[model samples]
Target: MYPAADTATLLIDGKWLEADDGATFPVTAPATGELIGRAADAGAAETDRAIDAAAAAFGPWSAETAYARADVLRRAHDLMLERAEDLAVLMSTEQGKPLKAARNEVRYAADFLAWFAEEAKRVHGRTIPSNRRGHRFQVLKQPVGVVAGITPWNYPMSMITRKVAPAVAAGCTIVLKPAEQTPLCAVAVLALLEEAGLPPGVANLVTTARPEPVGERLLADPRVRKLTFTGSTEVGMRLAAGAAATMKRVSMELGGHAPMIVFDDADPVHAAKGATLAKFLNTGQACISPNRIYVQRGVVEAFTEALVARTATLSAGPGTSPGVSIGPLVDDAALTKVQRQVDDAVERGARLVLGGTRLTEDGLDRGCFFAPTVLADIDETMLIYREETFGPVAAVIPFDTEEEVVARANDTAYGLASYLYTRDLGRATRVSEALRFGIVGVNDINPTGAQAPFGGVGVSGLGREGGVEGLDEYLDVKLIGTAL
Candidate 1:
């Protein structure tokens, strides 16, 4: 057994501190089914302290030149690179993803830091065409002051970096609240930034089991000028509502039931593989992972066969185990939810193609390992087809024509990301434009990038998280007018 960490430190203001209430939230390893460490449970008072620190530092931190901020971010990026392996292992231990996948997440997380570091210097405001001859209009981008960053448990490191990097790049101080289940990655990042010589109170992290109290307090405080979060739609709505009372700027990357469509003209082999990977990434916990798949009737049989064959070869075990392609869900609650969805679908006449049974006899009987599942003959009545199955589950529905496929894909309330696999350039262009999602991937499983705008429409969430758009979330544009 690996040695358990003595404490999961909370970085508040400029120093690492313990909880004032003396309460500790235990971090459980989903793979080993054991408690790994106890993180400080930040109460309302502690959150206030962190927010105050962030507020106090905002003036100086945001006053720094873009190059200065870029330099500090770059140093932190280099530190992350040097410790990638250890960071990945720690992430896998906490998040229950395969070691290889965890390492990729670490690299992906570092990419955000490095890319945003350079982009910090490029946070440019535009000059508007003169409406009046005497008055010249110049738009200036200024920092949005202290930002409250709330990140989720899945893809812990990447999620935190995605939010924090952009806010820092835009020269905003931050008070971060990482998910209690996976707070270590954020703590690790805080340590790296501390080592990189970031100014005191510029960035602070507080872990709390009661996210509502902490979140409410942070947003309600007038000192916080911007709010960014990545989590469920319900909670996102509540936070957005709270932030609105103060008219604070808010950006959210919420839940998704993204669709993947396979046209009759597409290569079944390639489409099948791509869909499987996209649907199963992070055991299907990703917000943009393909949840509803529409396949053209002509190629449905072939695609189904290819998908089943590929999924059959996947292995499930602890993240450290050799050749383990998938790991357990985050906890028992997640497992129960997935199982209920499958059961409801079956009752609603949806056909289970593979993995209809729970792996109760496996070594992970007590763990949260649900079988990677595929469903067919699904209709709108089934909960599995309508709700977000944030687990290792995929529903395959066949469509007759392009119009039918497009209609079926857009039937859901979510418009986060969509996938279409076809080699035909004309068809690809038309369908990609037709899809309502903010981001559309054609023959690409990895739809997100540091340079791309990441957000969704309808119930998915509001605003954007990455790209130039993300930096805008942490800035206020002011028109500086002068007659020369």
Candidate 2:
């Protein structure tokens, strides 16, 4: 996953250019707190340049045949898949995900490229049969000019590719601002696109030291016609509001406190495994990952026991290690936040069933590492159950009935993703429809993919990110009528 140093070039208008500011920002690994490498610190001027580039190419790119665009995406996808292993290690070093998970992210990200590549050829206009003689009506979808994509640190490669691939698939050019902490992978993506024969300005990357000025430049610029963001709900709201000032088309996939409900008839062991993976995947940093578990009282004890055993056995180490199940938090602040959450929950009377402390030994003393923690006997009033604990922590609560579980699961303001485990078809059917999440999994932990429509509900943010619905975010509908 190492960069060739000389190849970390910024692609603008088919040319590689240094940030006009002539600045570089150092990237640090969360596992060792050591310097990884420097990424170009794109400033206001550079952001403006990228936007201009995107705007300049929008007309030509949008007017191109869908087959042409699909061809480029397919090439990019094949190249990305071929280099998945290298990209995975690059992500592990910069993003602090386990190497295996990093590989999955690279593969997952590439799948979006492949999926959207095929989707590009499927963007068809609708013919509206006119009632009037010698008159014809047609409704067509046109690509929005330039898209400003703001991606988060978690799942950096996948997030950037997910947004940019669909936008390009819809024939839109893009100016992408990858999170400051993990911008290298975005650069690598641009490299692959360059190799795949995407003309310059169709996809551009910008790295920055300050989020405010760069974000403002992206939002305030009229050339940037659409805004897509994935991050905290608070930040997403602010971006959405700012984009509104210019009436920019906007889509957001924000925060979540997803709920996992296990019915009485579910296998306790299977339910526990799902809960563990869903909660602690990427050390629980995923926006849609399940945060709270509500088990029926009949199976609560067994589920808790199995969960505790599984969570306790998880080995916390560097993400590059082969057998490690969990890795360090993204940074020091995230580690502190998770610790504060556990402390607050325990102070409020939740019983700590497994882990509650950070591991600060065995060369991991300085790293941002928090042990996989499980708290049982948690109540609805507790923050751990009510808020998004974006860390390696799981809080479990017991419920009496399906109605009660559904009510409690939907109690939060965020309705991003949820999980349910039930052997009874009646319960599964009734509960699946009863939950208030945008995406729900029945006896499954991993539900998101390139083919499925992925997004959030409520305060979770607006619009979908994957599937055909995703391409719509970067398009405009136009109706034309004519009489012959």
Per-model tally of clashing residue pairs: 0, 0
RMSD of each candidate relative to the true structure: 2.2, 1.6
lDDT of 2 by residue, 1-484 (tens): 2246533446677776666757778888988889888877777888888888998888899988888998988998999899888899989988888998999898899998999999988888998999999999999988988999999999998898899999999999998888988887788888888788898789988777788988999889987889999999999999999999889998999999999998888899999988888888999999977888899999999999999999988898888987888988988788888998899889999998878998988988768999899998889667787778899998989899888889989888998899999889888889889888999999889888999999988999899989889888888999999999
TM-score of each: 0.97, 0.97
Cα lDDT of all candidates, in order?
0.86, 0.87
RMSD in Å for model 2: 1.6
Winning model by lDDT: 2
Over 1-484, each residue of candidate 1 has an lDDT whose tens digit, in order, gives 1113445366777878878868888888887678877888888999999988888888888889988888888898898899999998898888889999999998888888888888888877788778788778889888889999999999899888898888988989999999888988778888888788788888899988888789989888998998999999999989999999999988878988888989888899899999889988988889999988989889999999999888888787778778987788988888888999999999988888989655655577756888888888777888888899899888898888888788888888888999998879998998899889988999898988888889999888888877878778888889888887
